[model samples]
Target: MSASTPIARSKSAALARILDNVPKGYHRYTCGTVAARKAEALAQKFHTLYGIGCSPAQRLIRKGKGLANVVLVMHWPVDAEKVEWLLLATDGKGLETETLRDVGDKQRLKWLGYELARHTNRAKVMWTWRRTKEEMTELHALIAMQANQHNTAAISETLERIARQPGFRGVRTQSWALCEAALQRGYDGPLPHLYFVQKTNHGERLALD
Candidate 1:
């Protein structure tokens, strides 16, 4: 087929749009349709490239496809946050990593007709199926805090950033709503900046690094 063919041009345009949708500057797990390969084959690819026991987990990517879901071609070991942080801290576009940053070799090969192993710094699955009120409340807090992170720069800028994040519109929470209201009103009192407020043991003293 010639490069100028209609199908070729259409594919090129579609691929370009996919790349554009990808968050820039962050390392991405190049995902493919779940029907593309067997679990063993997918895991083997990562093992071959990264090292022994370096199996990547499958991630469901929900976007663009009307009723269809997508899964990873071969998940990369590093998560977007780790990649961004490593790049920023090292001041380089790429960074090195030791083998299996999180676990040993793949085990329990299969209990469900598939083996999905991952030792990546990937975030917890979003499980966008649904959320309870409490879960939604937590999401709002997380959103507000994420917006105010140093990476976010300013409040107004963070608001804009929050607006751009997907899967948040469905969440409804009074606390998050309050935070949003305060943020919109320019009331920047105290923000929920900590990821988890660790509760120390009763007799244990907190240690400062």
Candidate 2:
């Protein structure tokens, strides 16, 4: 089914809801101050990586078996209407940057294989002896280019830029720049020097820098 369809949207939303509650000790990647559209985009990414059919019980089984990594996309309420703090949950044992890279790579390879097999060698009849390998080599380069766009540095820069956009407010935290602002309401410790931008002087703000 197309991702744009209503049923597909519902399934994606359902999958995201299930992920809201996950096993303890999962790592978090916070994409702070997410609008509904951006949250949906992130949820679609998770849905693409892990199929929407996964259940909490099955997630536990997969984690136990070491056959699959548990992943979740979650959002918490923000003062702004129709926006939230989007966070990603994954196996906490590894670095968050590496986990994101690994997930992106696996998805790319899976799509590449499917496309090469489907387009160049339909019916599995081996239309050409070496066509599949040749196509794969060509496609791999394109995948590499796409992969570069999502590296740690690039993604961090993107998130930083997003944080500075109008409407986001609150003080930055020590753990990570994006998450601290979101968690400041409950955090009792000292806050950092960064803060998000507000377009106008009309809204309920957690704090001002």
Candidate 3:
């Protein structure tokens, strides 16, 4: 499906209207004395990269992801090259400044791949949870049972199986660990850091600083 379909158009139009009404070059708001700047930096970066103006409504949608309250609809050109260009531009700060050793790069790429895979699996798990909650519970219990029987290998195998199950798509073990670690550390917002850890043969962990 096209990214800028009718629904996307409506969302974009709403965001555009919000932006137009705001004072030029002023992108901050106050709910109380608690005032915070809008995501002007991110918006400006996006605009510079994609040649599209971003409005407060768009910023709200992005910020809402942290709150887990609102559904965001972002539109971009359907072409793969353009999509890559936008992503590359938006992601440049992380990829360029981050110092990743060879091993760390491999680990990070593995984690990224797993994350992508896990998104697909999550859909299945969600569908199963909705349609047959009891079955889903039992499935998880069975997997946990298998995981408990063995050591690290068993744990990894169990997780992989669960991930490969129909509807349980997306990244495997290390990715989940990274996500859990981030969440536990109070990363309730966008992924601000672009670092990953790699374990060495000497049982030491190296940070992709």
Candidate 4:
């Protein structure tokens, strides 16, 4: 047998073992449909990559398809305060225009991803193209502050910088409702999972793979 075959089998067996030992009375949360599907996909990826089961206990909760929301019940401990702190920290800084201009570079993406991963244990991230113009501007300023303390550029400088970037130049408003949603629940991280989702949609999932 090939070396990978045994490793794959071992991972599958470990998942089975984890499922068999699921605990009783696990609480389920409505994470929305897209979030739920994405979460499951992430869980599967984690199993394949690390052979780690997401939950130690299983509880049969309602399962629905074609629904806009996906729900899950996990038995792991959640640190709400920690999540909030992380989210606030991430939202406080916006990427510099120079950084955004270089976003097309492979090295930059990897560097940013590495920086983000150090703050959380999550393996994937998602990015949504759904922010209003005002919201996007505010987010950019916040990210800028987080990225640098001496970015004393005037509004015109910032606007000019943003205007020079091709992808974001015309996107006067980008949707950040997802970020707001995550913040509502006190989640904090650099949104690596959102980045993963964007790459997936662009057929660049292989980059992450």
| Candidate number of the best TM-score | 2
Write down the RMSD of all candidates, one decimal each: 20.1, 20.7, 20.8, 19.9
Q: Per-residue CA lDDT of candidate 4, range 73-162, in tens?
A: 121112211110000001111212111212223332111011111111166332212224455657555645533543333323444443
Candidate with more favorable, higher lDDT: 3 or 4? 3
Model 1 scores a TM of 0.21
Q: In candidate 2, what are the lDDT values of residues 79-122, reduced to their tens digit? A: 33444332335553423343242212322211111211112335
Computed on alpha carbons, the lDDT of every model, listed in order, comes to 0.28, 0.34, 0.28, 0.25
- In candidate 1, the residue pairs with backbone N, CA or C atoms under 3 Å apart (3 or more residues apart, or in different chains) clash, namely 32-73
Candidate 4 weakest lDDT stretch, 10 residues: 82-91
Q: What is the per-residue lDDT of model 3 for residues 12-65, given as tens digits with 9 covering 90 to 100?
A: 232222223222322221111111232223334434433233344654564445
Candidate 3 residue 15 C-alpha distance from true site, Å = 22
Among these predicted structures, which one has the highest lDDT?
2
Give the poorly placed runs of model 2, Cα more than 4 Å off.
1-23, 50-53, 65-82, 88-209
lDDT of 2: 0.34
